[model samples]
Target: MKINNLKNLFKNNFVKNIFFVSSGTAIAQIIGTITYPIITRYYTPDEFGVFVTYSSIIAILSIISSLKYEFAIPIAESEEKAVNIVFLCVGILIIYSSIIFLALLLYSNEIFSLLGNEHLNQYWYLIPIGVSFIGIYSLFMYWSFRKKEYLAISKTTISQSFFGNISKIGFGFLNMGAFGLIFGDILGKSAGITVLSKSFINNKCFSKANLSEIIEQSKRYIKFPIYSAPSKLLNTLGVQLPVIFITLLYGSSVAGFFGLSHTIVSIPMSLIGTSVGNVFYGEAASIGRKNPKKIKELSNNLLKKLIAIGIIPLITLILFGPILFKFVFGSNWYQAGIYAQIIAFLVFFRFMFTPITNIFSVFERQKEELYLDSFRLVLVLIAFGISKYVNLDSFWAIGLYSLAMCIVYFVTYIYAQKILNDEIKKI
Candidate 1:
């Protein structure tokens, strides 16, 4: 009877969406995991450093690509209004992509030089293209979530992962270097866009959203652009700081190891946490507005789920990360395994915190999120600063960085709980 009840609970729409999203993510990640051995064998760590550098640059810039107006799509009160928000986000993204292109044209060389990867200059032109694809995908994804089109989203995720990893391996064998990785990323996104466009972009929805509607919707969610966007940007920089600083301080080889470790850890996050978060965001927003008490209960349930699911994998990584990395990615990547061990705890915190972080949006606490992100940014910078000033080795420096971030993530979880409890009291 208990098992049946649990199975029934998992059949709820929120859980169903999570299941579909995770299933697709699992397939995608499996493909990536299988291909990684071949891809890593074909490409050197130094080359991966260049790829990571290029990716980090775009990752930071892409946060502001739509000024974050895309975040409002699912939260909008009505489908028509949400449709307008999508168009509004797309318009802003176009402008942002153009601005990035011009800036890159003017300073791509200097920027790559500063990041300690001048070799990335040849691929700089791809940044705008990559940004546009990612930005548009984010916007479209929110709209899909609003419509509860989980199957479509799942299909696109699988398509992207399948095509993207395959291309990277193919290009690697061809000796295309970092461009292979970059091109593969771009191609994967293209596949996603093509799938989503066919799935959701129709004349009826597009026609309902006009210039005036777009402008009005943008104003309605202006807080997203003003506060949420910068917070998101800072959060992204914090996440990518190791990639940037490792490259600058310890050189690209160390950065490569760190980047690969991060990529491996992020697979779980992308597959499970991100999928659940998207579904949770949609459901939480709706429930929080009607019966606010349900929000608290739902959050608690999710917290339990995240922690319960994450604990074992995290422990396994901390214990045998080096052995696993060597066995899977060859002896050359053993350093990546070590890096993974140091950061494994932090990844656990991240896995739990990321999905629930959307609770900030549910409670209209974007400002608090901004403050937390700012503090996180300071902590990351201090970690790098202390390492540089004290002449610490790469391993110790990374340890310090991971420790600080783990502390920050714990505080975030506490803060989120408090926010949820307080909101429950008010209701």
Candidate 2:
């Protein structure tokens, strides 16, 4: 009887949807984990650092690649309207990519010098290409969510993982260096987007989409381009700041160590939190539209589950982070394990908050989210600035940075909860 009841609970559409996405995420993460040890062995820390540095740049700029209009797709009132939004976003993305391409051509050398890495200059041209793929994939992903095509979304993730790793590992064997990792990332994104976009692309549904329709959709969702775009840019910079600062202040080696540590520790968040966030965004938007009173209950349940799921892994990392890193990734990554230990608390809260954080979007609270994200950016910058001026050791600097982020995440969570509570009560 108990087993039957549990099965029935899992049958709930929201729960089942989460399972579909998370199951694919789990498989993808597992594949990455299995292949990572080998990839690490083949690629040096400096090479990984170079790749990540470029990735950080792409991440910062990619925020506006689509003007973040992709975010509005899920909540748009109708599929036809959502299709127009996608076209508008893609139009912006093309113009954005062309602008970036020209900028890189003009200032690539100066930017490379500012980053304190000459090796990255060679990878400059790939930035626009990679960001284009990322932007397009994001559009397809949000469209998939809007349509509730969870299964297709899940399969694409797994396929992306499989194909991307194949290329990375294969290139490593060919001794391609950082180029291997960079291209792997791009190819993976291409594969995923191609899979998600087949139906929409084939039907040419947007061929009849007129400039006026695109303009109307753009204006209707202007909040995303204005508020959400800058907010997202700041948020990306905050997350990638550690990489940028570490590379500038210390060197690529330390940056690489930090990157590896962050990547490993974030597996659970990527695998579980991302899946939950996507599903939550869709379900919450639906609830907000039809039944506002249940928002608090949904938020509370999600919070409890996130906390429970995260506690054990975080505790284990705090206790045995270094040993785990050494055992899993090799002794060279021992320092990354230490870094992971310092950041575990922050990751726990971030993991718990990220999925539910979209509630701000569901409620059209982009202004509030923008404020919170800006505050986080300021705090992170201050943290790194103090460490730089004080000439602290890299370890202590990361500790300080980690501490700052943890506090910010906690505050953000509380703010979100209060806002959600107030909104629910009003409804």
Candidate 3:
């Protein structure tokens, strides 16, 4: 009886989207999870580790590659103008990312020397190309959100995961190793881009807003990308910084394990935390103009629900992480499993409060997020330094590293809670 009632409640729009988003993410997760085993069979842990490190760097570098335009798309005036804004942002990104890539090519030798990773030298060739693809793909996803095309949004991701990981499997079978993983990822983006290009051409959003209006509104809007973009990017970097440090201090294999664990943990996060937050952004962005009190009400409820959803999985993982890791991911990724468990636990704090902090964006608090993000960056450096000196293992490094980020989330959540309350009072 209770189970049936719970199911009924989730049928509501708010809950329904969460479930649907998570379901799609689950499908993607399964594809990626299956690929890991084949990848393990073919690549040495060391090789996998190098790829992992490069991937993390790529993830962080992605922030620079994209120039933080995705966040801008949703807040634009209308669907049509949003399309124009996105294309403009993409144009800016192309110019900058191309320059960076060429510079990287010219300075590749110096970079490898400074970074001190011989394996990384091989991956450097892909970085420039990866940046452009990542930037384009990001805009495509954001465009999906701007148009409220959730089904298309979900399908794109599911397809990307399926084809990308499948490519990895074939590559591993052919002894392509980590390069296969990189190629698989690139191919998935390329595939997604083709799909996006077709949809974009047909979509009438391009007819809605003119370039001048977009430029005007960009200057006028509360959620300008200049600040919001870097904050969002830093948030991603803060999470992945551990992999960078571990790669430098210990090696890429440890980096691989860290990346592997972080990727798995991020599944639930992307499915639940990110999905709901994205919806909330769309819902709450205009609440300040209409009814700010409603934003408070929604955020409070979301925090409660997010906490409830996070707790059981975290506790379960903590108790059985080692067993699950060994059983599920092959022997090579026991470390990955353990890291996932720790990260899951750490994520409890993060997931518990992300929704509330996200409300700040509705109120134009990107600067506040930047301040908190700055603190997180410092803590990341400290955590990395300590781990390097004390020689912590990969899983623990992953855990301790994320612990600092949790602090930022909690702080932001508290302030956002207060800000929403004040807005309610004003109303």
Query: What are the lDDT figures for the candidates, one per model?
Result: 0.85, 0.86, 0.71
TM-score between model 1 and native: 0.97
What is the TM-score of candidate 3?
0.89
- Quality of model 1 by C-alpha lDDT: 0.85
Residue pairs whose backbone atoms clash in candidate 1: none
Candidate 3 lDDT over 1-427, as tens digits, reads 9999998897766566656656666787787777766666777767777677667667777775545656767766666666767767677777877777787778877876666466667677687677778788778777766666666666666888888778878888898877887877777765567555556778655676477866665566535466776787777777776766777777777677767666666666645676678777766764444587777778778877887878887887788876777777788778777777777766777768775677666677778787777777888888888777888866566667778777777887888888777777876
Q: Alpha-carbon error at 205 in model 2, in Å?
A: 1.6
Report RMSD for candidate 2: 1.4
Error of 3 at 420 (Å): 1.5
Please list all clashing residue pairs in model 3, or write none if there are none.
Answer: 49-252, 80-205
Worst 10 residues of 3 by lDDT: 216-225
Residue-level lDDT of model 1, residues 373-404, one tens digit each, is: 99999999999999999999999999999998
Enumerate clash totals for all models, in the order shown.
0, 0, 2
Runs in model 1 lying further than 4 Å from the true structure: none
